[model samples]
Target: MYPPKSFDIGWPDLAYGLAACGRDGDADRWAATVERRFGDGGTKGPESAAGSGANGWEPAAGGGANGCLAALSVRSALDLALAAAALPRGSEVLMSAVTIPDMWRIVVGHGLVPVPVDVDAGTLLPAAAQWAAAATPRTRAVVVAHLFGTRAPLDSLAELAARRGWLLVEDCAQAYDGPDFRGSPGADVSLFSFGPIKTATALGGAVAVVRNPGLLATMRALHQEWPVQGPGDQARRIAKYTALALLTARPVYTGAVTAAGLLGRDHEGGLQERVGAFAGTDLMPAIRHRPGPALLALLDRRLRAADTVRAVARRAAVARRLVVRLPDPSMVYGADAPVHTFWLCAVPTPDPAATIARLRSAGFDAARPTSLGAVPAPPDHQQGARTAAHLVRHAVCLPLRPGMPDRVLDRMAAVLDPEDWGPAPGP
Candidate 1:
């Protein structure tokens, strides 16, 4: 079993807000800022790195995240992906199998196929040349997701997209701080998520940066026509996000800790129920786009805060111990990422069901993968389905957001010690 907190030992030292959702009750405030920032007549264009040429679009007509405020929400981003699919009904979209179910549902609901693809065993990227070969005429775009804090090899995908004249959609949800992927306008589009646990969790926000003015217009129109999310739904989301922030920030809070104490016996049952619920329904329809000023402020501060990166060994150690102690190790590190605050990708185990159980039993709160495909796959990439399936089957995303305490890290480590793996290793 891997030792807890060992991976996070070298995290860059920085103190920043860990509020995945908006801080306090700033959700509304953030939403307003987003609307103003990307409103109908915004002046700001998309942000571009130095080489993007001087044509960088001005910021939206209004004010928002110092520059990071999302113009949409998680759900809206999904819609934007579908819009870009340009797919015939039921056409397939290849995705890395190691993904969150929510993204899968979004693809299917949008009338696209969900093709799962495999990855490079070592780098956690699509196997060498696999993406190029997997393309099918029906494939419209290739969604290369830069998962966790790691940057995907966007250059490779960009090259492929150019040769094939296909769209390259960048899923920048988990890539909090990354190098800019902006090239010429039509080269590709980038989608960023600002959900809780994301680099800049602004309550609920997302953005799809497009170079094609026409495509951007289409996405913007879809967003404008989107049904207004109701109050109850909004309230529920707020509550859930708030609870998540609390649990993530102070999981040992009296209420949750006490509940675990009283209900640890049925922890497995609870996990099963949660998994079942997650499997049965799509949690997307409930979320909507609404950006405000407070969110923008928080995003700016958080991004600046992130300038101070620290080692997450303390958290990664806990995740590793749990991973090793689990019955399965085949998929322990499909993402092959180095140890950070936690084992950040999906993993292969005999039973995610049981492993989740053990983690909860040990007082660790883990979550499923983030998302799979909202963008379509390329025409030649038949392996997209395989990649996505592998991601689902083997990847294991761990929880290692900012601000976790040392004590909690120690407790987690104690539970996953190799000695606790049932047999001592030979010295």
Candidate 2:
């Protein structure tokens, strides 16, 4: 059977991360290096106009003059941003309806309300229309998440936020196309992640591109006050992912899954807990800290060395192939986006369990996502992100990778097509 997901990191990156643990480099210096790399103003892409990537307002490619900050994770960066902004308590922060649970949890933890903004079904974007409908007097900001490696058009959202005097934050954690592809040109703050399952897995780290200089300075000061992560913890994380890399190879992974089934073990559930960055840790203290030097150095090196352009292109190519092969393309979410990297490639089915079983029979190890959920709608606006809830309820995330055999796509299409599968199995 195929593995469910591939870790974007290689052994070389892990080895460097481990070696950094042995060195006693200055965390501040390393942070500077990492942040500088994040702010590297690559030659203007056809899409982005010229902007200086300096201390002053460097429109993160035309949004605002930009600066960069490194943090433990996107969660840490976001928490710092919210704290620095100091939006009034109980203010509503509109968020894309579908996002990792921690996102909304962190918003709630900061004494703000996370209001869900339903995403368009095909593009997986929270359009301005949805935002207008979701907003109220309490709405103070919009945390627009570009889901499934697709970048949302932000100019309109930015205009809306400006007119309404609301903060515009772009969660690009899953949409890192490459160095040239900075966050939305209009986002006040753009967050990126390099955690285990993210595009460029540094094991653990995050970088924020802050368009507002004052906000950047405030966030930096607050971040510095937090304790640094222990070197031992960084080393342990490196070791854990190293082992996981080996275990997730096709041969070992298939055997492990088979063995777990024979022994009635929930291997997938166990793996999920192991891979979570903040699993079982005290949220307040765990996220409220700076990354250690080892992690910072490794993250800098990864940022400098990664060929995200090639990686993302290949992933998108594979996703396009799959979409064309599928009998009903509408079943796939976010395929309509002009630029999608297929980070999760989730396809919705009426009976996801049966669909998964069929895909497994075809040697695919697709599984339901445990990480994404719908943010709650405010009290008076019930129905609560119906489309977001619908997508999550029936999503069967298929395992699609760049180098997978083309025949795999054909098999997945056959399994997904009702004509081929003869109506999904019933209870």
Candidate 3:
């Protein structure tokens, strides 16, 4: 029998995989260089532009010159949530049904009650009316995620939250520095993830943009109280972060689990469950005025480079034709949206299972939606389900990771052409 291939294409690009450790020497060098170049500009202290003072983020907080670090990922979001919910209990935290499990886990971890709202088709933005309808007397906050690097309509959501006197938490994990959404100032809190595969990855960290001072102070305290690695453990942690950034072939910590399943070495749900479980670790809780100065500098520089890469992918995505075509809403409403990971063309094929199976056999690794039933809301609110199912039936997420070879992209696209497959089988 032939041996399995060395590389596995899965969701979350391997280029940004967490499986490999960080590069110590390179990271050290980068750190020193960044310090020399950027100085204390974006560092997590009083000197930071993200407003390191007792007040809001300083202008020098190390994102773009116009940008400041914000807490928005799973790690630091806990701190943001705790601060937002200062009430004794019975607070209602409205969340979207289209988000990953991490968001729900954090909401439940806090003493707040989660009320999930449905999303619109195509773009998983929750209907402002749906949220308005779900609001009750105890509603304390509304948390919305910009899933798949697509920004959910936060303006309406934020306005609704404001009208009802509830805090609006914009989950900008996927929408990193893409563009400023309308009503950002209206939000009580906004968060961003700088994880390994995020739009702007510093390997592991997040920023929360707080419009309220009291909440910011409480969030800082909560971060300080959380568990931290001992001095002895810092070396190991830093080492891991370094390798993960530099290594190209390391088995991605996150993707390896799913990849193993795709390779048939593990039972179904093994990889998915493993991934969900590992999301609980606490990375950075406190907002360092200059969190990972080296990383901040790198992120600042990489954003431009990433935009260049994304531009090319966008052109390709626009040109490609799928075998089965599903209509997509053209033009993202948000001015600052990231280049999509997939252009998302769909087919109307009857047997998606067999189609996926065939693709897997032909050395391509395709995936089904992971957030299908993870939302806390009822079945009806999961409009992302219909969107995802529609996409999955005839669509495949081809490899679009940064630096992915164009030849591979073309080959994957070729497989999706309906002409390549025979007539659809009838029921």
**Winning candidate number (TM-score):** 2
- Against the hidden true structure, what lDDT does model 3 obtain? 0.45
lDDT of 3 at 22: 32
Runs of candidate 3 with Cα error greater than 4 angstroms are 1-73, 177-183, 231-264, 267-353, 369-373, 378-396, 401-411, 417-427
Clashes of 3: 38
Best by lDDT: 2
Per-residue lDDT over 1-427 for candidate 2, one digit per residue giving the tens place of the 0 to 100 score: 8778889988878887888788776677667666766777422322222222232112222322238898999999999999999999999999988998899989999999998888776788866677888788999988988888876578888999989989888899888876877788788999999999888778889989998889999999999899999879899999999999998988999999899999999888898889889999888789998998889867766675547678888988888898888877765788677777888887778787888878887888888877888887667776457678877788788888787677877887788865532221111
> lDDT by residue for model 1 over 1-427, one digit each (tens)?
1211111111121112222222333444444344343332122324222211232111223343332225445555666657654667866665654445566667777787766555554455565476766667777666555554545455666777778766666665655342233222333566665554454344445655665666665765665555543334334444544444344334334355457558655432343343221234445554444443334434433332322233333334545555554444434443354312232644444345555557656655554453343234445443334444444543434444344456654555454434323211111
Write the number of the candidate with greater lDDT, choosing between 2 and 3: 2
Model 2 Cα displacement at 319 (Å)? 1.8
| Candidate 2 stretches greater than 4 Å from native | 41-66, 419-427
Candidate with the larger TM-score of 1 and 2: 2
Q: Write the per-residue lDDT of candidate 3 for residues 375-406, one digit (tens) a residue.
A: 55533333233433333233333333334455
RMSD of each: 9.0, 5.7, 8.8
